[model samples]
Target: MRYLVAALLLASLPVFAQTVAKPMNDPKTDTFLRQFAETRRFMSGRPTKPRITPDEKTVLFLRAQPTSATQTLFAFDVATGETKELLTPEILLRGAEETLTVEEQARRERMRVSAKGFTGYDLSDDGQRILVSLSGKLYVFERATGKVLELKTGPGVIDPHFSPDGKQVAYVRGHDVYRLELATNTEKRVTQGGTEAKTHGLAEFVAQEEMRRYSGFWWSPEAKHLAYTESDTTGVEKLTIVDVMRPERGGNTFPYPRPGKANAVVRLGIIPIAGGKTVWVDWDAKKYPYVATVTWKKGGPLTVLVQNRTQTEQQLLSVDAATGKTRLLLTEKDDAWLNLDQDFPRWLEDGSGFLWYTERNGGPEVELRKPDGSLAQSWVKPAAGFFGLARYVDADRTLYFYGDPNPTQSYLWRVRDGGAPEKLSTGTQGPAHEQFAHVAKSGGLSVATTQTATTMPRFVVLRSDGTRVGELPSVAVEPPFAPNAQFFQVGKEGFHASVLRPRNAKPGVKLPVVIKVYAGPTTTVVRHSMAENLLNQWMADKGFLVVKFDGRGTPLRTAAWERTVKYDFATATLDDQIAALKALAEKVPEVDLARVGIEGWSFGGYMAALAVLKRPDFFKAAVSGAPVVDWLDYDTHYTERYLGLPQEHPEAYEKSSLLTYAKDESKPMRPLLLIHGTADDNVYFFHTLKLSDALFRAGKPHDLLPLSGLTHMVPDPLVTQRQYEWVLGYFQKHL
Candidate 1:
């Protein structure tokens, strides 16, 4: 009954609003957008993929080249504190332009990697040779000689990993897995019978996008065998993406399963690197169709985590290396659905036991379990927090972890065997907000990154005694304007929210408000990192107070907080946004609740559309980008997990659909602007078009703008700059 009657009734409805606004010339806005091009990235100087050598003599990381959006590999000498460039993308490619395959492009999209050159690499066990892929060709760089050798491998090769002994490399090509002998320069096909409809050693669409399981293969400890996934996607539905601007290029069709549709059938198998018979792991595929995680560590049995169709039940099974026989080691069942942790089910150095994280006590806690699946000890006591273990220091009998006691704030801590956990990061400088620390098991050396809403991320090396060794140089050009975000916990639920005021606003003046949100399941909006809110800060500077909060449905908190949206996705997510807004507005005098707006993309887009259509009194104007109008059009794993099967729980789908509200002629018609890319395959472009069709049938008015070739992600800097300007003008004109 919330949106039964809108503020702009049928009689008061105005003419269709303009879809495009004139570009405004603002110095501050121009400066902010220019940073994206000048820095080559929003937050430049960020050291990525920092790995300590086994000898602890050097640390290897990737840094952006100042002139171009490409990464160069650099090695930092631990003893001298001097950094030296090992390989530059220009020298490695020999000035040849890099060409990516379709598979590579999709992987980059899922990872949100817009930069180029040496995105990832793997070092050998002895740290002698580093294996990397450039433009679908394999390359090996010798650390001692500082020489790069590009092998004559064919195109479309991806995810090449060096064997444990560093004698061979395993990679995927044309849906099949292959092994290359480094000594003789001989190549052997490890697994055969792969087609376009089915693939081996490659993750399915849902696994990479939703489940966060990027790699589809696991290597055994002795380097003699490999475990990989074979996904048969023939059963899944197909969605076509067309480049309407070029009619000659018809469309590309791919298997994209919708809600209540068949998902790709996945099977796990064990293969020998020496070319032998394939051993398929046995499991109840009908009951558990989703493979969530796989782990194969030295001296331990191969383990896999599988979940049911509804994701309500998960089984952790141990696979025999030789026979591929599976035995259920542990099983977890929840009334709603199981949530996956980033780091869990990790084996100890001795391989006698492992660490398992569970929410049986209402929040996530670490528990040590023996290989026989018996409880050993409570490694980390039950607390209202989420924990992700970074490394286990077997010598000191301690495990280093990063967790958040409060959902919005994060810190690093160490938990010893039979001892209470001790906090290591105090955030003394400002707020430990989003701090991450990684410890090296060999040398007792660690690295930590600290950042806040007003602070740029900085990396520092630390000794075992928590003494700072030296800070690594960051090439990031910090923004000229100081961020004005104030963190607060509001309402009876203690919802975490950040409010950003206009940089030049006076203390007594109130400004119009905008709520930018992605109130989807398992996504958080309230993080301590400054980079997470740069766009919001820029929006705040445009004479609007920006507010973002993590509602009941999002993750990073207790299990109970997330369970509020079970079978009720629309109600809890929308209600919490409204409650947090009203509570924060009452507490802060700068928030003008009378003139409010909402904007978001993807899940946030859905929430934006839902806000105006359902609660017009609160959200006067909205801009929805690639919104999911109907639950029936969404994918299987994500939608069915939260709302249940469409057939079994039809009411849940009806309650979550925006089409129902659009067809209701009595409901108010607010100023809604819909934006989508015609080539958005993840959330298809038809979602907005279908909703527009419904509005037209109801004789309602709205605005629609479609980008020509953009996908679900806005990778082009110009496109992102224009998008912000368009949104700013729309809000200014409407609010």
Candidate 2:
């Protein structure tokens, strides 16, 4: 299999994108674009979402065939080092075409799942049953017998999960929660009075989109009781997204709360899965409206994380399932918006203690607490690059995690309950590459994706003794060439950045440059991974030097550096990008300042547009994709966190908005190309229209390319191929 993967990488796939993008002058770039789209940026055919069985013997994961977007479930036995097919989407659907309900489609969109087949699966606590949902239908795979059975349920089954005992499966359908008894093949409704406006066992839009809490229900340790959220989205504003290219299909209306608007009134409740009275968990909903996270473990209380509207404060409340009462266990506050750690309240099985992560002392750190929530020990000093726990081995009471010693690289580490931290991942000496570990619940087996220098991601299974068991094979096609980026730092503060020069360019000749920027919080652009620089190299191959840098607002840095962008997205970000560019130009003479352009998508799109308008003298042209014209048009949780409530801080909204600079006659706009999807629900299509309207009114020289029947993600191969061609063409023409 390894030989086959290597052979396939050396071989070539016929170009399909050229049929659509044949008009481009550079055939090499056109072929690269075609391959990039077909391979999903060379991301297809990679194993993902590996679920290690409870016994720590088998590893279950999802992978697709080479150059395919569809994925299938497979299992690997640790002892035999052999992999076998568990389930395939083709076999489930047979010859019929699969259909996704609107709710499921929206859910996948929120999760950013672009693949076609089984995107996710849930394993029973005993590891006997595997529950998966495809195209609104539910199925369970029995491990012992190797038999797959379809659970007879209503249409649009969402978030189906097996109970702790594995005898039953519970899911939300038609705004209500239902449980299916496996033995009798019977289904029972657990809740009543569910409507479109009041959804039971379904997460609200903001919670799913911003808070990263996808499921609205969780089963108890014994599987007797279930906790769920009932959300009332009555007063929230509705945004109707329509595919303008096909208007006859009508529009999709969804509850979308803007900044300062009414949010979903979500209430927590505990109800018996066997059908009984409901007990509502008591909390101050008016004060902390965001139900961030909920955790229920064997020896711990049912703790829920709640955040205030402004996200400046949050609290961890423990709820008594029987009495429906709550107690505040911990509180975290920040002068600006608080950054959350998803992995917390990790309770130990012996009921001795649990782990809690916080940033109250400046950066992220973890603390161990006793059963009563008293601090037992501070695990480590605040590490800015500390990612959440990968796993907690209950038997040994050790925690496995991924953390970065510096900004550009990350490694997997393990720390026993009372011992110091130890690095589990290797390749610590060379240029930075990402390392991730997934230790089994039983603690003897672990699967890690560890890379060094310029290698593709390889999922290697390792033993507890630090010996390799085997590698999970990947048929993912390699890029046309390795993206060997020149990694360095810029500015006096040493901001992380990378520059990619044309491979065949003359040393003395200067190259036109494109500064690709996505300097947003929670993400750092410049990394040591070769895969991270593929697009930059692709652009550089087209006779342009591509530069990318993580400015002050990017993560994996000091909290003070990220907080600088708070309430002011206009000046500080642009000034930092300019400073980084000027500093880079001082070091590399090949950086041609006379021909500089900028391009980005989403938040970066907003920045790109802001560049040409605010600093036209620096950026000659820009290609802004799916930009937010005004901060007021964005969603509530994200916008309000950075730029306060629009009602209270109107000046921040006005200053951050592209329309503000577009309307300013003193700041002249340069050549710009605006690309946006007509069906974009995140940063809606209204943004481009609004910005284009303002620019038109101001007599600005710019171009607008509207993608019909598309969303925020350009998943369609033809569409993305055309976008690359247009982006390069616009920059080449203007510069």
Candidate 3:
């Protein structure tokens, strides 16, 4: 996938200790693919979604047991570094099987959360209570008493939040916003009108998929009113996907905005906690229709970031809670487009100023802005490798962020109220080390997650003085073997690529090459984490040299470099991969470049099919999974950002489409395999069908595999194993 990867392996056994695999041409005694699937690509049992308590005394996180995707809440004491489990699904369900509503399933799919049982939680302001949602029911786990109670909520609830004072909880049910008083157990509907065409308090499709705004509602301080979104999908396109395998089960139909099509009309409103008339927030809806993000905090006014339909311009607006009026704090405009950074506009507790990260200065920099929106201080100089704000402690007047000189790695950096930025997480062994520091709001308590080329991932506790506390524990199942790979900068442009040869290959033996290409703007494939290379190693051991490349259009670079493929995705990225492959052939001769096969999924899958079609001399075969054949068929936000609206830039869409090449009967076609899930909503299965239809009309032969009961992400372990085997087998027969 372009936005995601095929396999995510963060934890592994002590196989990195060995420089090479034992014995020549040796196959792992235990199939790495089997362990990978059974362990959920080693993502199970990994600690995630951590929250630091207000007192800086504890850090709470959610984790599952080994080989399990069902998670539970846990707390880590900062003082003694002692860990304790707070709640489990087994205890809460009481032998009853946890069930999810269709709404909950769709919400998890949008959030990319495949895990079950406490996928997320909300920590109460005072740190005395924790709120979790399970099987569509809201539950509060009292920290002091170690008790869990279900709230008096109606069915089909998602995206639950707590009132600032921790006295009440609010959630969305049946497309409308609702609140429940914790003390009295009273439930009140905040909004009255809701339907399938119009919804309240939940994010729209593009907001969650492209803009990264998950929640459609925000609560004002003191729990006086609720600010929420009302989306009207009256004229938006309604698409349906059939349950082809299980015809009796039916399908799903929802609003999906295609390129140049009408998007859901979204507007904001504020309603009292006791349920009264809503005061709609006013803005220029025609100019800035996209609400990128919203924030309503204690010391700051109701703030929101709104963007234009094309995403070329955005404005930070400060809302008046009483009057429901807004004032433009700042306006940002770019020639190409603006990439939304979710961490920006962080409000300070004193209400003196806020931090804003903008690329208008050529690179990303954290600038402290006054209440009037003028710059007060620039915290860090503009860096091309700027990741984003990690943790901010307004009480201590300090910030911890992730950035590094290398784009393939992220390191933790710290800055105080007046001092310059300091590089924390010292003792780095190599450039492949990545660090993320989760600091408490009160003080300098940080849980640093550090991953090196040698280690999987380790979470260590640290104090303000850089004193070692202890480690946050994990029960991730280790893999049978480590990836035998080498990462380096290939070609003059320093494009990041990794080549994993068979661990048991001899010095002079030549092997076929398989290029794993995900060359899309949404993902940066070449990272320091071992999680990215496990699948590459498995492919290498299948008697092929697995090579991966992150070419042009990948993020974490200058706008000039990334926008090279602005209107033409088919030319620039594919050219970069071909050039890099030529350079690699000269650097390492153990792999035969002439026998190259390309494979990818989603946008990567588009490139895989393009490589074999457009460059038949370079790539012998391809395996394209869920590829987007036409940019015009994709969503509005992601597609319009690069190629503009289909109405204006029709040539760009024509040039970037895979069907354009597939229709050319004059070109020599290469062996190709197309795989897609019939029920895929995002990059729907119709994409593959279109390509196959075009190929058939062009008298070209190709293979197709339609998976049933799967979406864009095939989360089933057994299916993943069988699918990979089929892919490997296909390459062996064709390449």
Top candidate on lDDT is: 2
TM-score for candidate 3, residues paired by index: 0.94
Where model 3 places Cα greater than 4 Å from the true spot, the runs are 1-30, 426-428, 433-436
RMSD of each: 4.5, 6.7, 6.4
TM-score of each: 0.95, 0.95, 0.94
Q: Residues 355-395, candidate 1: write the lDDT tens digits.
A: 88887777778888889778898888667354567787766
Better of 2 and 3 by lDDT: 2
In candidate 1, position 43 carries an lDDT of 61
Q: What is the lDDT of residue 134 in candidate 1?
A: 87
User: Candidate 2 on 1-735: residue-level lDDT in tens?
Assistant: 232222223222111111111234465636888888888878798888888898888999999987788899999898898999889988898977779988888888888888888898999888888998887889999999999999899888999989878899999999999999999878899988889899999999888888888999988998999999999999989999876556689999999998888989999999999777889999898899999898887878888999999999998888999998999887778988888766788888888888888776767678888877788987755763576578888888777877675777777777787467777644345755555678888778888776543666778887777777888878799877887678788899798878888888788688888999988877877777776677678778878999988888777777788898899898788888999998998888899988889999999999999999999989998989999889898999888989998888999998999999998888767888878887787888888777876776777756767777778888898888877887877776777
Sorted by lDDT, highest first, which candidate order results?
Answer: 2, 3, 1
